[model samples]
Target: MLIRLAIRDVVLIEALDLDFSAGLGALTGETGAGKSILLDSLGLALGARADSGLVRHGADRAVVTASFDVSEDSVVTGLLADNGLEGEPGEPLIVRRIVKADGGSRASINDQPVSAALLRELGTRLVEIHGQHDDRGLLNARGHRALLDAFGRFDTGPIATTHARWRAAEAALEAARADIETAERDREWLDHAVAELRQLAPEAGEEETLAADRAAMQKGARLAEDLGHVTTHLDGSDGALAGLRQAARRLDRIAHEHEALATALAALDRAVIEASEAEDALAEAGRAMAFEPERLDAIETRLFDLRGIARKHRVQPDQLAALAEELEARLSRIEAGGAGLAALERAVAAARTDYEREAAALSDARAGAALRLDKAVAGELAPLKLDAARFRTAIERLPEAQWGADGRDRVEFLISTNPGAPFAPLVKIASGGELSRFILALKVALAEAAGARTMIFDEIDRGVGGAVASAIGDRLARLSTKAQLLVVTHSPQVAARADRQLLIAKSHDGTVTRTGVRLLDEGERREEIARMLSGAEVTDEARAQAGKLLAA
Candidate 1:
């Protein structure tokens, strides 16, 4: 319920603060006395569009703050938690908005900054404004389905889930069919490529190993002649080893004759031994470095074959193996295309069946709920003096192409104002007053369903008077028992029914004009109602009638 509204520098309202209780409250004043300005201010706080013209003359900005008391389980509380705003069970929820003269605006919930869109989303759950010109709430056919579901207390989560699953299945089936068709078109190429790869299978890293081996063998071929020359020099009859042996024998013959000769003979013997060891080491290296021409030819041939195949497939040597596996898998899928496509089709059929079952059940339930709703709304119309009118909840089964998560049915509220008249849409057939009354009747019918805590009716009693106005007032008061109701009315009958009455009056201070609201005391309320009854003048007769209306 809306507990308080504070406004500053908005249009004709310079500054105003009003506290509201939970019941029927009436704002009564003459036309053009700024009753609409108050509603606009409240709308601004509830995230309505901002306009620079709303700023009062000579003021740079306009601010509006609305506070409400929401229960812990109310939709408003859930929205607060969703937005990270503070709305403890025992505390009030505050929504504040400021509109600048430059046509810019900002909003906050509980002092935490928020976007205008978020504020608007939360506002819908907090208050619903209904009037003859309203396009939201009950009048909008687009929201009719949701209103019906809420009235029926139906949970639509299951059908929504089923519809999503059905769509996914359809998508999967389409993709599989496309894949099979493309693979069939390329069947010949896949077959040839897989065969070639199988015949000359290329191993990973084989190219680099073969190239390195070929390099080593070619280098060995180049060094073979030089190695032979060094071997001949080390082991030839006139080489360094043979000369060392001849010198050692001569030195040994003379060693017994002189000490100097013996020392020379020993050094020559050591030189001969060193030369022999050098020859052995050279021989071992020659054996290790030897290369055969046949082996070199085979390595070159293998490398060439690998490179040619890689170029043919538009891939490197190492990637040929992976590419081969992928092609083989595609070929296998093609061979089994008939079975795979059949499986996908069956899956899609199953999903469609499930969706249809759930959708049919929901449609049946909606039909039943629609009948009950029509009955409930019928009970409300006569009291508001529309006994000749008929209300209908029209549920049409839409075509399959238009099926959706909501169901296969389109629901709209239709009415016929006179007997034998065909039922037509609410907007097309009803006048402004009739539309307002229709909306009221619908609201009363759906009152038991969950909805916004506060409902504001803008002149719902516009064209009616006397008993009709009294009936409207009585209904408004009755509706207030379910939710807070604030009505802007000119009917004295309605004014007499209000638990609280506020008078909107405009005043001018020579050069400046302003509008203010004053809560009426019992005597003051009686006078205001009397003024309403007598038009600009308050006669003794009007006062006596006003007293009777209040006393009754």
Candidate 2:
């Protein structure tokens, strides 16, 4: 429920603070006693567009603050929590708006700065202010579906769940189709690439090993001639080592004849042994240096081919094996495309069946709920002076292809104002007065279903008077039993039915006039109601009737 509204420097309202309580509360005053100004200020605080002309003549800015008392689990509280605003369970939520003379406005929720758009969004859930020209509350076409749902008391959970599942299935099917298309487009290229790579049979590090072997073989080829020349020189037919050995053997045999000759022969034998060892080592080197030119050429060719392929593929030679594996996987997917596509189609069909089954169940439930709602709203219509007005909760099947989060049904409130009149859309057939009454009836019927803690009606009795006004008041009082209500009204009957009555009046302080609101006592209320009933002249009869009305 709206607990408090404070206005400062807004038009004629220089400074005003009004405290509101539960149940229907009426605001009554003379024609220009700033009643509209008070409502306008409340609207501004609820995120209505700011106008520079609304600012006081001498003031640079205008401010409006509206405070609401809501439950801990109210949607408004959840919205505040989502926006990171601080509030405790059952705490008063305050929305403040400041409008400047330049037509700029700032808004805040729970003292935390917020955008006007967010304020507007949060405001709609908290308070609904309906006026003669303000078609936002119930006459709006966009809100008809929600209104119907609320009226029908339809449980949206199953529908929402089924819709989400259908969407997921649709998305998966699309992705699968896209994948199949892509694979088909690349099938030929993938097959050729995979076959070529398999034929080449590239291996990691093969290029490096071949290149090393090639280099070593080329170096050996360059040294082969030199090794052969050395071998031939050391072991030729006129070799010096053989001649030295023969001389050493002859000297050693004659060594016993002379001791000095024997010592020289021993040194010559050591020299021959050293030369023979050198020749043997040179022969081993010659054998090790032997190389085949053909083998070297083959290794070089393989190395070049591996390097060229690696470069063409834009990968290191070691990565070729992994790249080939990736290409093979793609080709495999392409080959399995038909089977995978079939599987996806089956899955899509199953998902569609599940969605349709759930949607049909939901539609059946909604149909039952709509029938009950029609009866309930019709019951309320009699008391709200719309006995002849027909209320229809229309639930029609939408195209399956156009199904959405709300399921496959389009729900709307249809009405026929007069007998024999064609039942048309509520917004199209109902006049302003009828619309207000219909909205009140709907609200009264769905009060419990809406789960709203507070329901405010701003001049809902605008175009009605006499018995209709009294009927509207009776329904408001009935609605108050379920949720708190705050009503701004000019009807004496509505004013007389309030548990509390507030009089919005302007007080002149010499140079300027200021607006102020006060809770009227019983006597004060009677006078206020009398003033509303008789306009400028409060007739004795009107005062007496006002008293009788309040007593009743």
Candidate 3:
């Protein structure tokens, strides 16, 4: 609940601090006593736009601070914790906004600098101000669905989960169908590429091996004449082996004639043997070096074909094998997708069925809640001078195209002000007085779950008096039982019913007229009420009536 409000140099107020208590409080004063300015100051603290004109003529800045006492687990405190602005335990949460004369503003919570956006978010949790032009709370139909759901105790989680699953299934099916379509368009090209690659059948490292062999064979062909000469030198007629054999025979014939000739004959025998072995090795090498043109032709042809195919596919010859493998994988996916399509279609249908089942249940729950709500608000109408008017919670099922995760229903408050009158949106069909009374009735119905700590009404009793005004007071007083309520009204009956009353008055100090609020004593309250009852005069009769009204 709001605990304190301090305003400095804002409009007609200068250095004002007002302490607020729980339950119903009333603000009453003559017209132009600056009641609106006080509300505006509170609004400024709640993150409303800053205007330099609101600052006092001689002041550099206008500051407004609103303090709220909230439970540790309350939404306001939760918001503070979420924003890292939590203050010391057992301390009140304070929001201070300073508006400079240049139209620039700064906001803080518990003395920690915060953005205006965060301040506005905190305001929504702390207070709800209702007036003729106000757009927050129940006035905006966007909030009606959640309100109805909250009232019904219907959990929307299951529907949301099913909706998400359905959407995922839809997205997956869309992507799969697109892939299959694209693959089908390229089916012919894939088949032709696969057949050609299969026939070529390129292998890894085959290009380098073939090129090396071809180069070596070409070099050997160039050296064929030289290699043949080496062979002839060892084994041809009159070659080294033939000469060595003759020498060895001569030496062996002279070995029995002398010992010296025997040693020389042994060395000659070894030399002849070595020469014959060399001749045999040379003959073997000659056969190996003999070039085969057909072998070279075959190697050159294979290398050329592989290189040409690689160029056609814009890949290295060694990469041809990998390219073929990738094409085969893609082709296999196309076939697999053809079979997966049927299964995915079934999945999409199942997901949609789950979503619809849950959504239909939620929609039915909303219908039941709306019926109860309409009855509740209708019961409040007679006491509020709106017995002839009908209040309704209109639930319309939206078209499939407009359906959302929230549900398929559009919930709005509708009204009919007269017999045979067509029902229209509440805001459009109701008069200002009727709207305020209708809002009061709705608030009374929803107070248990309103979630706001403070609710303020500006001129809720406007254009109303007598028993109707008293009934409005009764409702406001009752509303205060569930949450803090502050009503700014001209109705003396409303003022008389307040647990606390503050009078707004303009005091002239010759140089300036300043607006201020002061708590009124019983006698002072009577005089104020008397003034309201009798207009410009505070007659004895009015005072008697004021006393009677206060007593009642």
Candidate 4:
């Protein structure tokens, strides 16, 4: 509920701070007394488009701030939370807007800067301004479906979930079909590539192993002739082993002749044994290093093939094995494509069926709701002096292109002012006064389902008086029991029906004209209502009538 509205330098309202209480509050004064200015200021705070003309002369800018006390579960609270603008849980929600003289505006919620569009969206949830010219709230045909659902207390979650599932299934099917078509286009290439990779059979480490062997073979070939010469010197009959053994035998024969000779003979025998072992080691090394010329050529050919295949596939030689597997999988998918596509098609169809079933059921439920709503609104029409008028909750089946999560129906409130006339849109069929009354009846019928916490009616009691004005007053009072109501009016019956009355009046100081609002006391309210009942003055009879209305 709106608790306060603070406006500064807005037109004639140089500075105004008005405290609002619960229940029906009436703003009453003579014509041109600035009631519209007050509502315009509130609208500015609620994110209405800024106008440079609204700024007071010589003022740089105009500012309006609306403070509302919102419940934790209120839509306004949820909107604030969604925007990352948090405040103390029970504190008032402050929406402030400043309109510069240049027509640019800035908006903030709970002191956090936000876009004007966001503020407007939250405004729709926080307060609904209903008048003959209102294009938001109940009169916006776009929101009619939601209003009807709210009225019927319908839970659309199931249909919404089903719709999502159906769409997802359809998307999945589309993606799969697209993928299969692309894969089919590459079918021949995939088959050839898989065959080639399988034939090459490149192993992860095979390239490294082959390269290492090729290097070793090339090095051994460079050393082959030198190694052969060395082996000949170490192991042939005329080489070092033979020569050492011959010397040892000669020394053994003269060993007993002298001690020196004997020591020399022992050394010669040890040299012969060491030379024999060296020759054996050389023979073994030659055999180990040997590589056939044909073997080297074969290894080089294999390495070249592996590298060429890797380049062709845009992969390292090590990835060739994995690439082959991937190609095979694609081939397998192509071979089994029909079954997979069929299964997806079945899923899409089933999901669509589920969604359509739920949507149809919801449409039926809405038709029933529309009937009940029309009956309820019919009950309120006559009391507001609209007995000759007819109200209807028109539900039209929308085309498939317009079908959505909310279901496949377009809902709107239509009215006919005369018994034989065709029903037309509420706004188009009624005059300004009739339109306001129609909105009021619709609002009263919607009751707690009307969405906004606060509702402002601009001159709803216009062009009506006597019991008609009293009945309108009683209904406004009745509507206020469920939500805060602020009505701008000239009817004394309506003003007298308010739990609180504010008097808006303009005064001139010769050089400047200013508008101000004052909360009325009991005597003040009586006199204001008297002035409303009479013309230009408050007569004794009018005061008495005002007193009786208040007492009633």
Candidate number achieving the greatest TM-score relative to the actual structure: 4
Lowest lDDT sum, 10 consecutive residues, model 1, at 71-80
| Tens-digit per-residue lDDT, 1-552, candidate 2 | 788888899988888888878777777776678888887888898888889899999889999999988764457777877889867665788899999997788899989899999988887887777655666766665666666667666677776776787678768778877876887788887788677778778898888788777766777789888877776666666667767877888887889999999899988988888888999887776555557888877887777777777787898988888999998887776678678778877877887787788788878878887888788889988766788888887788888788877778887778888888988877777777777788888887777666456666767887779988999999888888877777878899998999998888888879888878889898999998888888888999999999989998
Regions of model 2 farther than 4 Å from truth: 70-74, 81-92, 202-303, 316-318, 533-548
Model 4 residue 406 lDDT? 84
| Residue pairs in candidate 4 whose N, alpha carbon or C atoms collide under 3 angstroms | none
The Cα RMSD of model 2 versus the native structure comes to 6.9
Report the lDDT tens digits of candidate 1 across residue range 111-192: 8999999998888888899988888878778888988999999999999998998889889989988998999899899999
lDDT of 3 by residue, 336-370 (tens): 98688888899999998887888888888889999
Cα lDDT of model 4 by residue, 409-487, tens digit: 8998889999999998887778989889988998889996857888999999889999999999999999999999999
Backbone clashes in model 3, listed as residue pairs: none
lDDT of each: 0.90, 0.80, 0.88, 0.89
- Give the candidates in order of TM-score, highest first: 4, 2, 1, 3
Best by lDDT: 1
Candidate numbers, best lDDT first, in rank order: 1, 4, 3, 2
Residue 170's lDDT in candidate 3: 88
